[model samples]
Target: MSGFFKNAFLIAKKDLYSELRTRQVLGTMIIFSGLVILVFSFAFDPAQNTTKAVIPGVIWVIIVFSGILGLNRSFISEQRNDTMQALLISPMDPSSIYFGKLLANFTMILIVELVSVPFLFLLFDFHSIGSVGYFLLVLFLGSFGFISIGTFLAALAANSKSSEMLLPLLLFPVTSPILIGAVQATKIILSNIEKLPDAVAWMQLIGAYDVIFFVLCLILVEYVMEV
Candidate 1:
């Protein structure tokens, strides 16, 4: 158990350090998210009261796209210097590598979401932080589902001729459920609709999706890496 954790931590730390040094992945994500927000602000008239109606969709769209950007680059650092091949050849269990990469990607997604949420509120002038806790919980759960499938897909597509294009094609459809659940939950929370049952159902769906994908990705990652 200790050995597993040790290896995972080491792998995660290496990725973290590389990200800190280059800031390539995160910088692009933040800039892209900001630009999306800016475009929406001008493209739609904020004074016309359409902002609230569109804010939820806009926020989720930015998150989903930005997530794809981050996930696409998740394996770039490793592949750039041929480190991924070395890791695959190592004695450590492949599951550890998958988990470690997933953890790092999860952290990046969460950070991007965190930074973008405030920008979203500011851009659309959403005053009431109604159900902020629920919003964050939904984000975390949704992101977990995304990262699980994304990590596996990223690994599988990393060496492809057009990995950048292939990943979103494969990942977007598989992860759509989580995105739908998240968007619905956000809509309910933002509108302050008092129906607890609907929100609960959405949350349950997100949780189930997270669990299923996490296990599925774990099992498939080893096979993908082997191939």
Candidate 2:
């Protein structure tokens, strides 16, 4: 079992190193997210409470779209260099490849969120976390759901002519429940410390989504490889 996760980490490290060297996915996502946030910020003056009210949704939009754009890298690199075939033909477990891809996507999204979120929260004047630990739990559960489904769909769409287009159509509707739950959880977490019950319920929903999709992808990826 340790060997399984070690392989996943090794693969994740390889992608992370390549990402650091090339600045391919991360650079584009940061620039795009920054621009979108800036545009959205301009649309609302500080005097209006509307921006504050919409902070959770705004953060969700920023992360989701940026992630969708970046998720292409999950399989494109492998598809491009014929590495998918080599990866499959090698002795590595398929679940390792899925988890490795999931790790990279998760790490990438977390970095982007951490970098962008301070400014995001400051911009909206939100600092209402009941517990930092619980807030991070929400973040991880939410991101897990997003990346798990995304990595699977990205693999399925990697070879298509209109893969970029296909991914959004395939991804958004199926994942909307997690998105809504995450936004609600964030809004609750950021608004009042007393709303622990609401936040926990949403977290449960997000966790269930993560677990279901995660196991489904682990089983289905072998067929995705065939596709």
TM-score of each: 0.95, 0.94
lDDT of 1 by residue, 14-122 (tens): 8878899989888888899899999998888777765677777887787778888888887766776688889988987788888888888888888888898898778
Clashes of 1: 0
Taken over the whole model, the C-alpha lDDT of each candidate is 0.83, 0.84
Q: Model 2, range 1-227, lDDT digits (tens) per residue?
A: 88779988988998899899989999888887788777877887755766677777888888899899778877888877698888888888888888898899889999888877777776656666567887788778888899889998998998888888899999999899999999988888876668889999999999988898889999998888774
- State residue 178's C-alpha deviation in candidate 2, in Å: 0.6
**Model 2 clashing-pair count:** 0
* Cα displacement (Å) at residue 98, model 1: 1.0
